[model samples]
Target: MTTGSTYTLQEINALSHDDFVQALSPLFEGPPWIVAETWSSRPFRSLDYLHASLCAVMYAAPLEQQVALIRSHPDLVGRAALAGTLSPSSTHEQSAAGLDRLSDEEIAAFSRYNQAYRERFGFPFVICARENKKESILAGFEQRLHNSPGQEIMLALGEVAKICLLRLRDLIRS
Candidate 1:
C-alpha cells in the first residue's frame, strides 16, 4: 500500500487480487494470507463487506491456524515496541493509545502482564490498541488473563477483527 494514501472503494474494487493482497497485507501483524484468501470474495459490496470477508477467512481457518494467527501478534509494550520493531500500523496504534509514553514502572508492569498472559495462553495478548487507552489496556490484560484458553482465543480473535477493521478504514474510503 502507498504510504499516507487512501483508496476509494471503486479503486479498491477494481484492483487485481495480487494488488488487493499487497494493499491489505498490513491489516494483520503476520502473514497476508487472510487477505490473500479473502481476495476471491471481492469485489466487496462495501467497506464492511471487505472487512467481514477478511474476518471470515480468519474465523473459518482451523484451530491451529487461528492459534498461529494469534501467536503472530506482538505483546503490548513488549520487546518489539521498545525496540522500535513494530509494523507501521502497530506503531501508530500503540502511540495513539499512549503506549509510547509509558513510565519505567508502567513498562515493567506491561512486561510482567505480557509474560504472565503468554505463559497462561501461549500467545501474545491481542487488543485493538487504537480503541483503548493505556489504562484500559492494562485492565484488559488483568481481566483477560483469568479466561480459559478457549475463551481467550476467541476473545483475541475478535480483537484481531477490530484491529483489522480499523486498519481497513484507515486504508479504504467507503
Candidate 2:
C-alpha cells in the first residue's frame, strides 16, 4: 500500500492473519513477527488497542530479540542513508529530520556518534526522527551517549514505540 494509504479499523480487523502481517509490516523496521503476534489479538476495539497490542508483543519478547530489532535499524545519516539504501519509510523519516541535507562536518559527527553508540551499546542509536530536527538529533546523540546499556535498550525501544505510534496514526483510521 502507499505510505499515505490508511486502513479503517473495521477493515484491519477483518484481514486474514497473513494479510494483516503484510499490511502492517512497514510499521516496524525489520521483523513481521510483532505484527504476526498481534494478529492473535484481532478485532481490536480501536486503533489504540491495535497499537498497544503490537508494542506489547515486541516489549514482551526476549532481550536478545529486542536487541536484534534495534540492530536491524540503520545508523542515522550512515552508509545506508548515504548510499540511498534505506527503506522508503526510513528514507522519508530521515529526510524529514534533515539528515539527507547534512554537511561534511555534520556527516562526520553522525558517523562518530553512530560508531560510538554501536561500540558502547552494541546497536545503532535509534530515535523518532520525525520528532526531531538536526540540532535536537545531534543533542540527543550527545545526551543518549551517557545512558547505560540496559537503560539505552529501554529508551531505544521507547523511541521505537513512538515511531510505530506515529506510523500507526498515519495508517490507521479509528
Candidate 3:
C-alpha cells in the first residue's frame, strides 16, 4: 500500500484483514498470525481509540500470543527489514545508538548477551528502539534475562505497547 497520506479512521477501518495487517507490518517483524487477533475487529472511531484498544487487547493477550508478539520484534543488531519504515527520528536513533554500530568489543558483548537472553527467555531480546541507546538496550537485555518467565513476559508486553504506540503515532502523522 502507498505510504503517502495519513489514513483516515474510516479508511483504516475499511481495510481488508490483509491490508490492515500490512499496515501494521512495520510495527513488529513477526508472522501475520501474531496480529491476526487484532485484525479480527475494525471500525475504529479514531487513532487514539484504535491505539488504546489495541494496547488493551495486547496487554490482555494470552502468554503464547504475548510471546509471539515479543518474538516479532526485529533483532537489535542486524539488517532489520522494518528499519526504513520506522519514523525518521526513530531510524536516526537506531542508526546513532544501535548495537549494530557498536565497537568490536561491544558487539562481542552484545552477542554473548543475545545468546544468554535467548537461552533464558527462549526468544529474541526486545526493546523500544525509539527512546533507547545502545548501553541502555544492553542493560535491559541483561536485566530482563534475569526475570522469571512471568515477569519477563509482562515486561515484553510493555515493550510491545511502546513499540505499537510509536508505530500508531507514526501512522497517524504519515
Q: What is the lDDT of residue 149 in candidate 3?
A: 83
TM-score of 1: 0.96
TM-score of each: 0.96, 0.96, 0.78
lDDT of 1 by residue, 1-174 (tens): 225668998888888988888888898978888988998887888999888999999999999999999999988998999999988888889999999999999999999999999999899999999899999999999999889999999999999999998888889875
For model 2, the local distance difference test gives 0.91
The superposed Cα distance between candidate 2 and the true structure at residue 123, in angstroms, equals: 0.3
Model 3 lDDT tens row, 1-174 = 124446667777888888887776555546655455577667777777787777777778787887887776655664352345544434554665664467878767777887888788888776777768888988898778779988888887777777777767767642
Q: Estimate, for each residue in 1-174, the C-alpha lDDT of model 2 and write its tens digit.
A: 126568899999999999898889899999788999999898899888888999999999999999999998889999999999999889989998999999999999999999999999999999999999989999998999998999999999999999898888878875
Deviation in Å, model 3, residue 134 alpha carbon: 0.7
Alpha carbon deviation, residue 7, candidate 2 (Å): 1.0
TM-score of 2: 0.96
Task: Give Cα distance to truth, residue 1, candidate 2, Å.
Answer: 9.2
